[model samples]
Target chain A: MGFWKTWFSTPESVSATKSAAFEEHTASTGDPSANSDRIVFSTERDIDLYELEELCDAVGWSRRPLRKVKKAIEHSFLVASMWQVRGNQRRLIGFARATSDHAFNATIWDVVVHPDFQGKGLGKALMKYVLKKLRSEEISNVTLFADPHVVDFYRTMGFMSDPEGIKGMFWYPH
Target chain B: MGFWKTWFSTPESVSATKSAAFEEHTASTGDPSANSDRIVFSTERDIDLYELEELCDAVGWSRRPLRKVKKAIEHSFLVASMWQVRGNQRRLIGFARATSDHAFNATIWDVVVHPDFQGKGLGKALMKYVLKKLRSEEISNVTLFADPHVVDFYRTMGFMSDPEGIKGMFWYPH
Candidate 1:
């Protein structure tokens, strides 16, 4: 691995080891909370509209019509939520939603970690939960758009800038 | 409107005019062909995998594993295909796909026009069809990643950069 990185070479062929490594990594780390916070992650898509709105407002995302907001949450293929459960009450703290064809490609969107739980790895945990779900469904090619400040954080989790010529674009009618 | 652009706005309340203008725009030009090319756009989610594969390959996007490619196409919420029909045969010349929660957000992906059909405005027409679908569904936040070179093309269609502090990120495990 050391020699391969320093020297120039063609991008290597798909290695048999990568699939095994990914499976092992996911299997070992699958459902465990990384630290003592006990932040539970849920893949249920039944999040309440008011709760979602509060999360977005807390993060300063633009306020949108409630119906539109609800559509975005319910239609996602993988909707992961991070929670802090005390006895019977579950407080929503982090969220990450993905839209994918459940096969070739998926894009992660609107990832938020409640301000109160920002320092913990809840966001990462939410993403990992989604990734594991996608993996089980055999989907690949996950993508997302983050604010530049958090780009480095996503990079730490295996995302990279567009390869060569590809770029990201969007239009907001507001 | 001009003053609103210059100052630090708390992101004012959603305006009524924007929605009216959007409705007018779509109502006026919604289904018409842009020019003499006679391109027809369809919002049908069913697509021919071989044709899609050929389009992706033409654009030199890394060839996705075949099953993943098939799944990506099947799962899109809105798949806008541009066709040039000649006497009962429909040719798939341009393609774009999106996945949205049909409410607050949608992301466009794998936009490609066959190299033979590149100069025409089919790409824009396909996008317009998609925007209309999203608009009718009441989805508001729409995003896509493009190469920096064509950012202007997307801009002309009303997409701006990462609003001030935002950035786009992705991960390709291949």
Candidate 2:
């Protein structure tokens, strides 16, 4: 079988490999503390849509249809979420996803951090973790569409606007 | 099964449905003439990578690894190509692919037409066919990253640069 057929034939193994790698990384860095306010990060896709929707709503992003949001999560190349853990309770605080060609290019989308979690460096850390994961998979070009106000935030993370004179264009059918 | 599972479970059927729809549309408009020059568009993914690479090279795009290209095509939601048909000979003259969430949004990539095939209306036809397919499936937001020189070309097709003040950003890890 070709690489494509082989890769798709066993998506579970692929996800397992990613999850294991992420868990190993977290283990080395120190797992989530049981009694602290530190936020724990996860690459698991089995996230709750209600919590995700609430996170988006908390940031003032217009309500996206939960059905469509679920579909997006199902098809994404990767999804990263951050949680504020206290004892056994966990609260979803950040979310982001990427759609990639799985080799040469990947574009990040729908990056959102709960309003309560903003300005605390958690957003930056979320981005860093996401980028690190993409880089580990050997994807070379990473791109994203950002709002005008947050352009500087991305700039601080080594992202340049319209690099090499490539501009993003959109079409909304009437 | 949920929509995502059902969708991915039968990708072949999805491609077949698209191919059948495209063929029906073409047949209704007018079939390609055997004695005259006419371009035929297809949504098939079983294309020869060498021909596609040649088409990309003809447009002066940098070389992309064929292995990676194959993987990209396998993962894409849609891949459209145009051919210059003359009897049994069909030459690949245009190509484009889209990666989507299967809802909400999609991004087009690797849109290229052979240099020799430019100036004709083939590129516009290719884009129209792609947009129609996406719309048929109810995707609302369509986007693409374009070279600065072709910004006006896309603008004429109702694509605005950075719509609603959403700027494109890139990160290239060193």
Candidate 3:
């Protein structure tokens, strides 16, 4: 079987989870349709997705299956999501994730800003959301990485060079 | 189609492997015979097997035969293997893994201590090996999940409480 057909042809999707999470993050200063150089913040509760490949292709997000997408959603829930919007349109502009036990710890992952909207301070805005939740929840420390040049951005957010931090690696199946 | 047959019976078993590797480490100062306290740390390069299922069941590590292991191994440059030993002799005590980029970033995985040696700090000793190597190489960061009560152990090792740091979810295909 072909790669696409073999991996993504299944009709069974993790759709319609129907969570009441909207009650948690009801604060947003901007609107999805508001026209400006501004962005909107919202916490979607239930996301029904079927064609991850098609959706990711359309929006230029990485095309992965249910597993990766679910990880993205779960990570976003632990932190909060900030959308870079022009007017009513929204895209996954900048994001930071958290791994939390809700009592005394949380870790951050995949903090990214869309290349099209990088210098506009969207990253700062997204970090703002992550930091607010982490600090208020008594999650004293938040950690992450930077691509050498962007190290300054994290430093501005109160993260310093953790010369002794842990390590991350990737392996290919070839 | 039987489980064992499908598992252990491989036609190319004899000559397929490129080579076998056995590196050395200072076994934990704790009781070496305590089966549950022992953990094994190996790299993909160290593993000589091709079939993923065999690696999965090698030492009873809970993992799926996904591209993740392949990626980790590739990133690790074949320095990885599954550990399985009985006692005292410490014949590869248990199974540990890496998430490597083949060149730099790689996070170790599983790190199963044999059933009989649960709380003897063997697992921690194995992690010490991975951390030391990554740190010496000045790696990006390492990530993994410890069993809740063990979070403090990881924290002491400088892993931020970002369980959400590298969150993942799955829905297996039928």
What are the per-residue Cα lDDT tens digits for candidate 1 across B8-58?
A: 232321133233323433444454552222345555555667877788788
Q: What would the per-residue lDDT of candidate 3 be over residues B1-174, giving only the tens digit for each residue?
A: 222232235434212211111122223333445434323444324343344445346656565445444443443312323244334332434456543332223445555555444454555555655565565544444555445555666666566643333322111111
- How many pairs of residues collide in each model? 13, 0, 45
Q: Look at candidate 3 and tell me the lDDT of residue A154.
A: 71
**Quality of model 3 by C-alpha lDDT:** 0.44
Per-residue lDDT of model 2, residues B85-152, tens digit only: 56656688889999888887789998988887677556777898789889988999898998999999
User: Retained native contacts per candidate, as fractions?
Assistant: 0.79, 0.89, 0.01
Residue-wise lDDT of candidate 2 within A81-141, one digit each (tens)? 7776555567888889998878777889989988876776767877887898899888888
TM-score of chain A of each: 0.75, 0.79, 0.58
Considering DockQ, where higher is better, how would the candidates rank from best to worst?
2, 1, 3
iRMS, all models: 2.2, 1.0, 14.1
Please list the residue runs of candidate 1 whose C-alpha ends up more than 4 Å from where it truly belongs after superposition: A1-37, A60-63, B1-37, B57-67
Q: Is candidate 1 or candidate 2 better by DockQ?
A: 2
- iRMSD, model 2, in Å: 1.0
